[model samples]
Target: MSPVVVLVGPPGAGKTTVARRIATRLGLTFRDTDLDVEELTGTSVQDIFVEHGEQHFRALEEQAVATALAEHDGVLALGGGAVLSDASRALLREHRVVFLDTGMAAAVARVGLNGNRPLLLGNVRSQMKGLMDHRRPLYAEVARHTVLTDDLDAAGVVDEVLRLIEQDRA
Candidate 1:
């Protein structure tokens, strides 16, 4: 199987952009868990949150992660909360996982005040901070490498990840 790299981070941490560049540079396929989940469930994630609940959405997220891990050998960008699930964490441990660490301020700035993010609907700043507090440690736990994305562009982050991968290989 081709090598797999899993990118984990909170929303707006530039995981998708970095993953896309890394996948392109490495000549690997790119998969986004959110996109796949939406495609599979025939519903947008925000709608899923509105119709069901976060628990149900997380279930789909877990399934999406599993499917991506099993079927794809490339750079995969996981939903911000995917690592909250124990099963997802376990699966991630089996592959090369990179945590994109971006501060809440930067994340909020990047994501903006988007209502589509159910978790960030009301009091987004506080919610983002709280989520980061809870998720950052978990991400560090599963990450084989961590790249601070505070001021880095997508290409810079990709280069950092590539260097980390090379170091790990060595």
Candidate 2:
């Protein structure tokens, strides 16, 4: 099976929050690859990165994303950097992908330079800016629909995604 809704975006774009709400509204299950990776390792995403390193964490993330895409028939949320994998991006193309586009300012504000984020540990703003800028094209490449989450609350983003799903169905 494949996901009915797949969320792709940078950190703080509300992929997890928006995907969960959309799943509930659609009466479907919600799954996040980050959570899946954590469950697999019995640790947090940050811990995985800290312990085994980014490359290791990314390898695990790619596998988790692959499995979830093949097996899940629900709303799926990808880790921020999941699209970095060419394999993952290719897999995403066959699904209903939505890009939660967010500006650097809004993203930084939402994330708040949290310690929980492994990649943004050094300088959250600059790191986030770079990450977002680098990933924007990848996200757009895989997503059939795009919603700028910078100006919208979770509910508003959810509404837009729902509308896109509905429109896609029609």
Candidate 3:
């Protein structure tokens, strides 16, 4: 099954929210690999990171993205770091992928310092900065489209994604 669209971005980039809205507007289903991983392990993402470590979580995320990319037929939102996997990046090249780009201030404000995010542990802004800096290229390398979400609301991002999907259909 081929996904209608796949969304990739750094954490706090509004991927999930925008995907849900796009799915609703398009009358398609919404699937998030992060939630899939949680269901697969019967635990929260934070717990997985805390208990099994980032490598383990990344493995699960990679598998989740692989399965979703191969099997899902709707709007799919991947975990922020999913593109870090070469296999996932290659698979993403076969589909319509959108990267929701955001600025550091917006990402930090959206994510916050005291969230359950596993990557933003001690110093949220600094860690998020590092994460975004390191992963931006990976996101760009696999994405077919990139929408800056720093100024737009979720609806605005959804509008852009819908436009991208329509362009793909055309």
In order, candidate lDDTs are 0.90, 0.94, 0.93
TM-score per candidate? 0.96, 0.98, 0.98
Task: Write model 2 residue lDDT over 40-83, tens digit each, in one string.
Answer: 88999998888889999999999999999999999999999999
Quality of model 2 by C-alpha lDDT: 0.94
Off by over 4 Å in 1: none
Give the poorly placed runs of model 2, Cα more than 4 Å off: none
- By lDDT, the best candidate is 2
**Pairs of residues clashing in candidate 2:** none
The clash numbers for all candidates, in the given order, read: 0, 0, 0
Evaluate residue 141 in candidate 2 and report its C-alpha lDDT on the 0 to 100 scale: 99
Q: Of the candidates numbered 1 and 2, which has the greater TM-score value?
A: 2
